[model samples]
Target: MFYQAKSTCLYCDHKFTTTKVRMSKTKVLKRDSDFCIHYDGPNPLFYDITICPECGFAFYNSYRKLSDHQRKKLKEAYISKINVMNMVGERTIEEAIHTFKLALLTASIVNERKFITANLSLKLAWLYRMIEDEAEELRFLQNALDDYIYMMAYEDIEQEEVDEDRLIYLIADLNLRLGHYVDARRLFSQLITGKQVSPRYKSLAIDRWQDYKEELEDGD
Candidate 1:
């Protein structure tokens, strides 16, 4: 009987040892030839001995591979559900930020509808601002703004429509939050001049715009 060594099955997490009985292929006279091995009894799940970096299992799927298609779709679905959650609740903020980022990544991969793309971009920007990723926050907000503006003016319409004004201020608010004062001030001023945003938010945006400009000038 051949001696067996115990090891963790990296693929499925089954703990076991190789059976004592084994068969090995004859080594080819040629050196460096591919070696073939045969085993008896329950075949240990292929389970690579090498560890999986992302998942921490020797053969288990990496996070990327585990999430490849279905997990991403699930993330998108979760994000879709949390879209209606307001900002005030205990779990709301966490859920919003998580789903928003997931949606942004998934939307980029899936070629979803324009609003999903637009809204995810907007939500991701806001989430980044909340977490203090200022540069990333502005970059995403600008992207959302571009997506919304392009969609509102033109871009395969008939699929869906939304409150463009709300989106405009949402983007502006993101900029304000991110300390992109010049950009925020410009957008808020334009929206206020056109009365394009809701009165309440527009007033808030204007106030923020003024504050942002003040900070800018003081800093200068």
Candidate 2:
């Protein structure tokens, strides 16, 4: 289910082979409400972030190409400090978490887009959920929620492939998971009643809102 792929480091231009999961070989078991996929075998999410053995620059496909100034800054601020680890081959869940954390750090150091950082945080949260680490999961979920909210407020959604309505629903769901019930309820209501929202996400918001209400009633 894994194959070696060649990658060039964005900062150092080091060509290296890295392992990736073949999605065709994996079967989808189910997805959580937050859209984390469960697989029958090795999870592909573990291999999504590629880490450079030379410069320690970790990134994914959606990452923007580094400018010359950004590269210089990365070298001075990050590359000079850390010991580069070889994360080239097959990875365990813990190893994946390490690479993801490295990618998040890289994103921050270079001022990567909020959308990309939000995705990295969300995936990191999902990895923590797989390990039943509730504390870490909620922590990253909050990071994702904050980034997504920032993106919605100041960034251009048209530039990215992300659907705005779905993003709103995700923000609302993250609020729910983080125990921010008032914000969750208000955002979910916005999606449920918005005239311009897509039917698919609207339906999803309604379903999740109903589930939350039912859970509250059952608890009482």
Candidate 3:
């Protein structure tokens, strides 16, 4: 259910092979509200980040080629310090987490966009959730929430091709998961009432809000 794919490292231009799950062979079991997908076979999420053994640069398919400054900074701050491990083979959950952490570090070093950071944090949170590590999951969820908020406040959603309503919904859902009920309710309301928002997100917001209220009432 896995195949090796050849990839060129963005930082050092090193050609290497990385393992990937054959999506055609995998079956979707369920998808969480947070968009964590459960697959019947090997999870493709685990193989999303590719680490180059030559320079220790970790990245995903969406990552762009680095500038000279970023390359220099990475060499001084990241590549020179850590011993690059050969992670080209099939990755375990622990190995995937390790690669994701490295990618997060590299993303920070180059000042990668907020959306990308948010996505990486969210995936890390999902990975932690898979291991039943609630503390780490919440921590990364908080990180993702913060990054998403920053993106909305300062970044250009249109240019980034990000759906604004979807981002808002995610922020709201993350707030709910993190127990920020007041903020979650407010955001859910925003999505529900915004005229420009898509009906899909609006319906989703209403469903989540209603379910939350029902849970509260049931508990009481």
Which candidate achieves the best lDDT against the true structure?
2
Those runs of model 3 whose alpha carbons end farther than 4 Å from true positions after fitting are none
User: TM-scores, in order shown?
Assistant: 0.43, 0.96, 0.96
Backbone clash pairs for candidate 1 read 51-58
Error of 3 at 215 (Å): 1.8
Candidate 1, run of 10 with poorest lDDT: 28-37
Cα lDDT of model 3 by residue, 63-152, tens digit? 768899998999999988999899989888999999899989999999999988999999999999999999999999999999999999
Error of 1 at 151 (Å): 2.1
Error of 1 at 84 (Å): 25
Error of 1 at 35 (Å): 62
lDDT of 2 by residue, 67-186 (tens): 998988888888999888889888899999999999999999899999999999999999999999999999999999999999998998889978888899999999999999999999
The lDDT, on a scale of 0 to 1, for candidate 2 is 0.93
Cα error, candidate 1, residue 36 (Å): 59
Quantify all predictions' global Cα lDDT against the true fold. 0.49, 0.93, 0.91
* TM-score of predicted structure 1: 0.43
lDDT of 3: 0.91
Least well predicted 10-residue stretch by lDDT in candidate 2: 53-62
